[model samples]
Target: MFYAHNFSYKTASKSLPGAPDLDEEDSLEDAVVVFFHVEAGDEDNRKGCIQKFVKNTKWLCGKFATKSVLLHSFNHLSGSKSSPEFARGVLDEAVERLERAGYTVKTTPFGYFNEFSIHVAGDSLAKVFKEF
Candidate 1:
């Protein structure tokens, strides 16, 4: 995940024309763009991913007084990515948990390539990388 000084996103086009949009053009300050990549290995450990994500989010929020998160699908982190369906499941679960934790969660729709701009923070914890 990358901490952002400012972040914004826009739904350019649907990955599938009939697919529903999950987000709209919006901007946020003091937020984190969670590029949640679902690796092939994550298919078998979905629960672990949800737990780790929540734990990491708690840490980030407390450390930075962050209240907003943008969940973006980014499969480039690893050579192997989970199936699209599996990834969606994981993403849905993460959103649910994060929202329950009182975070303002915004999600880019699954199965779509979106447009976004982010000004990454320069602080020590501005960018974080974790694998589960």
Candidate 2:
């Protein structure tokens, strides 16, 4: 599952103990925020799945013309979720790919609940959702 939003502002309000420390004290602006879920079935085509996800993310970023991206693991979208370890690895790989392509990437704390404050763009293209 994939859901993305072009945001003018976004910040993590609160996170669990294990969540990574935020590098930026202020809210991030001009970015695409992606909420994705990995299902257990995806394990059959892990590499290809990740590549498609990354490509779609880049496509959305291009539509918004932003080099910044935020990835959040959201399992609430479906019942058949992948193992947390594997899901996290996927996020990590996506981050590496995006960074290699010159996009600044940020991830919310994995395996934890976070409260985020976001101001999404008014343009219709700012919101995108897909399932694969």
Candidate 3:
């Protein structure tokens, strides 16, 4: 199983583990930010599961009419977590897919607890949750 907790944010920023001079900081506006969690069972059909993830992400972004996305690896959504390597790989692959489709994508630093400041739109559609 996997879960995608999504938000449509007016603005968002992530900072930690990287200095400003290193260009490791991230800031986005009018974007779909997805807190994605990959479960161990998802690896059984990795390719298919990833395909669904990408599709769901794109669908959510489209709903908000944004071509920008922020992918964050948040394993706390479930107890049975996939390995860090597996989860990181899933995030990377999703980035490639999103970019190929002409969306600007940013991913938080993997395997680390980063700080995020998100200002979400005040609407029911601004927040969505999906599990599969």
Candidate 4:
């Protein structure tokens, strides 16, 4: 399996069931964060990707399956702090996709400025990439 121990993602499964890659630290409140990419592509491909993502993510939301969900997309990640305008455009789509997937999805943005982020707490590990 392809692995990268040095990768930047830090995980904690005891808390979020699925051990989602967190974008922020745990608070007194219970929540997990996952930042995903929307990779460069055509409009049709992009829309299709979002649809498929929503479909699969819906399956992930099977157990802990609360209304809580979030979505973030980055065409490219240079740095988190320098891209508020991009966030401003796709943030709504993120919220919308989660809500459509049976999640209550918070309208509040996750993480510090420019950092593309999503909040998930378990029930989504099924969607993360796997190595054969």
Best by TM-score: 1
lDDT, candidate 4, equals: 0.39
Cα lDDT for residue 5, model 2? 44
Q: Would you give me the overall lDDT of model 2?
A: 0.75
lDDT of 3: 0.72
- Score candidate 1 by lDDT: 0.80
Candidate 2 lands at a TM-score of: 0.80
Strongest candidate by lDDT = 1
**Worst lDDT window (10 residues) for model 4?**
1-10
- Candidate 4 ranges beyond 4 A from true positions: 1-32, 42-44, 73-91, 107-127, 130-132
Stretches of candidate 1 exceeding 4 Å from the true structure? 13-18, 21-23, 76-78
Residue 132 CA error for candidate 2 (Å)?
A: 1.6
Residue pairs of candidate 4 with colliding backbone atoms: 60-123, 67-104, 80-114
Higher-scoring candidate on lDDT, 1 or 3: 1
lDDT of 4 by residue, 1-132 (tens): 011111122222222233334544322122223345443342335455555655554554453343444443332344333234434444566568776655665422333334222333333342365211
The superposed Cα distance between candidate 1 and the true structure at residue 12, in angstroms, equals 3.2
| Candidate 3: clashing pairs of residues | none
**RMSD in order of candidates:** 2.3, 3.8, 5.6, 10.9
TM-score of each: 0.86, 0.80, 0.79, 0.44
User: Residue 52 in model 2: shift from native, Å?
Assistant: 1.1
Q: What is the lDDT of residue 20 in candidate 2?
A: 57
Ranking by lDDT: 1, 2, 3, 4
Cα lDDT of model 2 by residue, 64-87, tens digit: 787888888887568898877788
Clashes of each: 0, 0, 0, 3
